[model samples]
Target: MASSSMLLSLFFTILLFFFLSPTLCANSQGNALHAMRSRLSDPNNIMQSWDPTLVNPCTWFHVTCDSNNNVLRLDLGNSNISGSLGPELGDLKHLQYLELYGNNLRGKIPDELGNLESLIGMDLYNNEFKGKIPESFGKLKSIRFLRLNDNKLTGSIPRELANLSNLKVIDVSNNDLCGTIPVDGPFANFHMESFKNNRLNGPELKGLVPYDFGC
Candidate 1:
């Protein structure tokens, strides 16, 4: 009888673990977002709902989640929040939209963001970001709209960006980018205005002209 009791106890423990696994994952994603809130300066109290004590971040304002309580979107655009993005943001594996435009945010875009494979739209325009665009961004296979215009970024555009076959609208204009713009893949269909206001020499002319000329 004692052996049967021990077996039942073990089964219950395993069942409990499986039942709590999703909640545990949600808590971890919440902690990642809370880490970001700790680094930012929120003057408008827009992040008041980001209570870490909650089981998940699904209840937080400006945050959206899927039916399974996985984070889906963060709509903090033009909220007057200012701070460099944290690498912890990469923990939102289900995130689709990340809108942080028109702020005073500075520093390099975190290369860790490349881990957001489910990302669809990433809008970081009209900010004060600098440094080279992360080559890791080429891993964003699901990304469609990528707008990083009107910043202070410099360096040659990463050639690896040409691999984003799903990319539809990409505007790197009004920055300090150099080198000839990529002319293959999605870049071939983009208009010159999308690459305007920068120091780009022009489009890549393939073998006739070097793509990195005068960069």
Candidate 2:
């Protein structure tokens, strides 16, 4: 027998090059996320529910996947998406839930998204993004739900976010931020609506005022 049919055609050509080399490296990051969705400028077309020929990005439509298909989640909230945020989204290297809430995305927010080191969850809330908040997001230590609430970020709040020890819920509430908010670990069990109505001093709540709770 022709040497067992030449070792069964070299074991099906090494199992078709190990199953087409991880689907050609997950379609080369799904063709760079479909060429960054054609240089987004969605106006108000609201990404027409992002269709890019389905298939990868785990069959599109608010994409979410994992079973080796990669891309975990991308909610696209309040869909009136305006622009900015395309650092080819750090090549979605197994992205974990990125929801752009109340859309109208402006700029900044992208210090290459700290290269999504298996990001847990990031929601860019009530958008109109200004600047500051990107000290590479304290290098997302497998981040656990961080919401940049009511955007227009100013400065200060980055005490390297107290080194996000797998942070469990952080909301940089109502921006134009000032300072001094960094109290001991996890900001002493954050509340007071997570520092609502900024330029904060702290510790007051109950319908603030008295120089907005100048604690």
Candidate 3:
């Protein structure tokens, strides 16, 4: 009879863990947003509603979450924010739209952002970001719109971007990007205006020349 009582207690503990573990896991999404809030310098206080003590980040302004409370979008565009992005932003695995344009953000775009497999539109234009676009961005299979224009970025556009069949619009203009632009897949439809003001050697020549022709 004592052993039966112990078994009942153990069964209840297991049941309680299953019931509470989801809330704890969802709270981590809030934690990820709070981590991001702590990193950026929000001068306009646009993120004033991002209270970390909340059960989840669904209540935070500029942050969108799904029905299950998974983070979906972050609309922090033109908010006069400064500082660079960090890897913590990658924890929002369900994120789809990341709009961070027209800010004072600088430094290399974090490679961890490529881990956002659900990303659809990544609008990071009109910032002071520098360095090569992360090659890991090739992993963003769900991406549709990629606008990285008007930055200080250099180096040949990564050829891996050519694999995104779902890509519809890509604007790398007004930067220092060099080498041949990928003319394969959806890139074949993008006009020269999408690639102007860069050191690009023009489109790829298939078998005649290499993709990294200029730089």
Candidate 4:
């Protein structure tokens, strides 16, 4: 009888662990977002809802979560918040839409952002961001809309970005990018306007012109 009681106890313990697993994951994601909140300068108190004392960040404003409480979206565009992005943002593994456009954020786009494989839309336009665009961004296989226009980013567009089959809209206009545009994959469908005002020489002419010509 004692053995049977012990087995039942073990079963209940396993069940309890499974039930709490989602909460634990939510708490971790919350912490990641809270770390980002702590770094930004929110003069309007827009991030006041980001209370680490809470059970999860799903209840916080501008944060959207999936059914399992995994953070999925962060829409903080044009909120007048100013500050550089933190590497901790890469911790949002399930993030899809990261919209921080039209802010005064300055600094290199974190290479860690490339770790978000589930990302769909990443808008960092109209900011003061500089430095080379992270080559790691080529890993964003799920990305659809990548708009980094009107920034001060330099360096050649990573040739690896041509490998993203899901890319539909891309606008790197008004940046300091160099080199010939990749003529393969999704890049084939993009127009010159999508790359306007940049230092790009033009599209790659295959064997006639080198891909990195004058870059």
Q: Candidate 1, residue 77: CA error in Å?
A: 0.3
Q: Which pairs in model 3 have colliding backbones?
A: none
Clashing pairs in 4: none
Over the stretch 24-94, how does candidate 2's per-residue lDDT look in tens digits? 65676677676666765666665565565655556667777777777778777887767777777887877
The superposed Cα distance between candidate 1 and the true structure at residue 22, in angstroms, equals 1.4
Model 3: lDDT equals 0.90
Provide the overall lDDT of each model, using Cα atoms, as 2-decimal numbers: 0.92, 0.75, 0.90, 0.92
What stretches of model 3 exceed 4 Å from their correct place? 1-14, 209-214
- Candidate 1 has a TM-score of 0.94
Over the stretch 1-215, how does candidate 4's per-residue lDDT look in tens digits? Answer: 99999999999999999999989988998988888887789998888999998999999999999999999999999988988888888989999999999988998999999999999999999999999889899999999999999999898888889999999999999999998888889999998999999889899886674466556
Scored against the true structure, residue 98 in model 3 reaches a CA lDDT of: 99
Strongest candidate by TM-score = 1
Error of 3 at 152 (Å): 0.8
The segments of candidate 1 whose C-alpha lies over 4 angstroms from its true place after superposition are: 1-7, 208-210
**Sort order, TM-score high to low:** 1, 4, 3, 2
All candidates in order of lDDT, best leading: 1, 4, 3, 2
Error of 2 at 176 (Å): 16
